[model samples]
Target chain A: MTMAADNRPANAVPRTANRDPYTPQTLLEVAVEVFNERGYDGTSMEHLSRAAGISKSSIYHHVRSKEELLRRAVSHALDGLFAVLDEPAARHGRAVDRLEHVTRRTTLTLIERLPYVTLLLRVRGNTGTERWALERRREFDHRVAELLRQAVSEGDLRADVDVRLATRLLFGMINSIAEWYRPGRGDAASAQEITEAVVTTAFGGLRLRQ
Target chain B: MTMAADNRPANAVPRTANRDPYTPQTLLEVAVEVFNERGYDGTSMEHLSRAAGISKSSIYHHVRSKEELLRRAVSHALDGLFAVLDEPAARHGRAVDRLEHVTRRTTLTLIERLPYVTLLLRVRGNTGTERWALERRREFDHRVAELLRQAVSEGDLRADVDVRLATRLLFGMINSIAEWYRPGRGDAASAQEITEAVVTTAFGGLRLRQ
Candidate 1:
């Protein structure tokens, strides 16, 4: 799990504020939070300024438009996820091992980049940025589906289920983490613990003696 | 799967137009579709009217407001899910069997009530009705979590994993069906086939020889 933290993209900003003044990264963190709270369509510059305790002009100073903030936020998330595929483990391992590595890392990335990924999931193809995000998301899913197909061909996974459906369910289980996983909430599991449970419960099943 | 079709609620309106005129149920179906395409907050009575090819006054005659349509849509989905718990298989069977029955039925209900469930899943707690829907959704999750705990206590499920986390992942996988599942889409599996895949993939897992 520490490795998961270490692997977070250098550009990935922590959710908490560390300074009295707002930087672009901090502003982005605040904007993404507000975006998640209020849908992208519902949010306005006034909302962002009020939430940031800054002037509307100050917001414009940081970003040209609200869609810019959305683009930056989702790009951050997409970048983090896409980077996982380039890791040594994901690139050069047995098909199942590579798939597991990607799965665990993807879970960690979602946890680390919680707000950004949540925004990415909520996008409704309403804008150019959102449509681009959707297309990139499809490309990512296709890549993982290919891995699943390879694993099945390698005799590592069950042959009974459709490979594509299996991939959707697997990622579905992973993506749903954003809905309920509140970091630092009451008795919440740490990222490492969640990664382990997700892998085990998903691949190992709930049945005893598996 | 035919059993799934037969089990559709008496009040469940077909997605297609069957009558020459509109009823409240038919109006709701149209409203929910537009609400999903354009988010609930983003949609207007004019949009609903335009999609339904009727005057805005006609829409008001069928429903009081947009919020009413949202409340009605989610309540329909919630009702269908809660009814699954009342069935003989869910109430009288062993904990494992009951859990499996609930899981399978939840998937089928989500499919049968696709548009409504999709709207239900996207509610962001921005309105009174959304808040109510969120509360009802939490209550439903709590009920299923209790069942998982019972299954663990009965020695039917793995005890290593946390029950609450397991339940969230379980429903997360199930709830995500709304994201990519389009009924009558290219070579899509039947509802029964999907239910079987969800059960087997979720409980049996993708690992070979498990």
Candidate 2:
């Protein structure tokens, strides 16, 4: 797995005849796959190296440690989800509409970043990265719950259910997308289709009208 | 953690002054807790021993192996969930009402068997027991999906959404209760209340009604 000894610039095209170079981004993708397969706690550097088709030292050259890989993967997922909140629809719409927008976008994001989001969801607060992910997830949930509360107060949603419980059930429905959704598999639903289903089902229950 | 050497049968009450006797049921509970704290693959017999406050030999006395404990835990959870389908409300009603009964009962069973259900949710198909659990879970899901199909055919539910997707989202919302739910933690909702919320949120969205 050693690169050629020639002192070509690191950014230049790879000198190796057959081996693909490992960028941090590519390595992170490999690491997330391994982490999901073996679990974050069960994966080892050797396991990652085998899966990536790279050596341990080569992996270290890209990321310092496995935990760093976890932090990066979940960070990407969290970033995608948190970014949804700032979209024009999420920001400017009526509370119910904004909540629907967030819900749809969040489902799309989870599908777009399936492995990273799956890792984020499976975290059990076992490490700093997992705990941090949990906290950020809570923050995101709270923000959505606030949207639900506002929607209810605006007489747009049902007032009978607890906002916190409603928010959890809504996202719970969305997040479960990661568990069964397989991208590019046989007859998989398009991201748009899933988003529509999630939005309709979630808001259909919460909205006061048919 | 050795039991006193007595000629009495293993089932006899313990002779130890202060130590509580560990029944297989009690031991299985401890194993499930440790398995959840540590990912099932990451947990060892030693870990179970530590958590159970028993010796390795004593743990073996109750169960042949860690996998046996896992089998027991998941079986208990699966039995509870599958039993919901057998209830009269689930078996004989309007398709929509039967679906609602299954949804509400599944939520209550999840809360009632939180740890076992949580473990069931997090299994990653790493071992035989895990694989078996996954297959059983799929069968259960397929059964519910059929109910959704029936409901849609009967015009009790909206036909716009895919029946399979609707069933998945419904149970996804129900199963996620295992992730964040902490029974008796603080002002926790009762099983009946959560059942009401799940039924309302899920059917509220699915039913063809105002």
Candidate 3:
């Protein structure tokens, strides 16, 4: 073991000399995977390095800390979700229709950004970043709640159920997709089919209409 | 800052001589609170001891291990859920009616056993006990799926949506109550209101009935 002393100059073998360099983008993909698999708290820098096939020093080059990786991932997911609210379909319609449009689009956004949203849904507000994510999540929910209230006032949605409770159940059904949905699994529901299932069950009622 | 070594007999200041002894039931409540606060993996026997105001050795006198506490908690929740299926209303009614009854009751069960079910919902299958809990959960889902299929065949529920997917969504909506519901808290929905909201929005749909 003592015979392995290096004689080569420091410049002879740079860290990135042997293969493609690890970019922040690529490193982030690995970090999110590890985080989702082993929860945000359970994951450590060493886990990320082992998962990414890089050294601790190499990982530091890409991100400042694990929380930075978390912020970047959730921000991507939140960006996708918040954009759905701005869609023309979501914006210019009867309140019920607009609510449905938002629901449909939010479902698609969640499926498209499954890993990120899965991570987002599991945040417990233990850190400043997680608390910020939770606040943003509440803002999104509040916007949706307003849409629901408008729909109820317009006599479109059922007026009997509490609008806030209805909103939670609606998104609850959508968010549960993260717990079980596997995009490429055998016999998986097509995106169109899943979207239809959500909209139809949520708005049309499970009982057949006359 | 070193403490003086004890010179008295061990029985002079026995650990539990002056305290309300830690029973398994109260110990489990403390353990679950800690587990939910710091995830199961994050929690330790030391954490449990600190939360219960007892020593780890005292805890071991009541339960075998942390996993035993997890098993006990989830089993309590699961027993409440599975018992719903055996009720006369659940077992003897029309399939759709039975499904609705089960849904309404399960929602109530979750709210009643909020802490227990909350811990059950967060199990990640990291240990044998968790995996067992997951299997029991899936069995419960399968039973409900069968009820949904029966309802679909009976022409009570709509036949268009996939039966299993509908079952998942229905229960998903029910299960999400664990995330935000705070029993006895100010502005918390009473069990009656919560149950009505779930049943109405789930079966009657959120859209106004003409």
Candidate achieving the largest TM-score: 3
TM-score of chain B, candidates 1 onward in order: 0.89, 0.88, 0.90
lDDT of 2 by residue, A1-210 (tens): 112333222335443424547678766877887888878878899998777666788778888988999999999999999999999999997888898888888988898888899999988787988999999999999999999899888888888788888888888899898888887777788889888888888767522343
The recovered share of true contacts, given per candidate in order, is 0.75, 0.51, 0.76
Better DockQ candidate (2, 3): 3
- Model 2 chain A: lowest-lDDT 10 consecutive positions: A1-10
Better of 1 and 3 by TM-score: 3
- Model 3 per-residue lDDT tens digits across residues B1-210: 001224222223344523535556656776777898898988999988877666777888888899999999899889999999999999997999999989999998888888889899988998999999999999999999999999888888899899878988888888898887876678777878988988988888998988
DockQ of each: 0.70, 0.39, 0.67
- Per-residue lDDT of model 1, residues B106-186, tens digit only: 999999999999999988888999999999999999989999999999998999889888998898889888888887767
State the lDDT of candidate 2 residue by residue for B75-125, as single tens digits.
999999999999999999788889877887888888888888889998889
Q: What is the TM-score of each candidate against the true structure?
A: 0.87, 0.87, 0.90
Mark the regions of model 2 whose C-alpha exceeds 4 Å error after superposition.
A1-20, A206-210, B1-20, B206-210
Candidate 3: stretches off by over 4 Å: A1-20, B1-20
Error of 2 at A88 (Å): 1.1
Q: Name the best candidate (by DockQ).
A: 1
Q: Where is model 3 chain B poorest over a 10-residue stretch in terms of lDDT?
A: B1-10
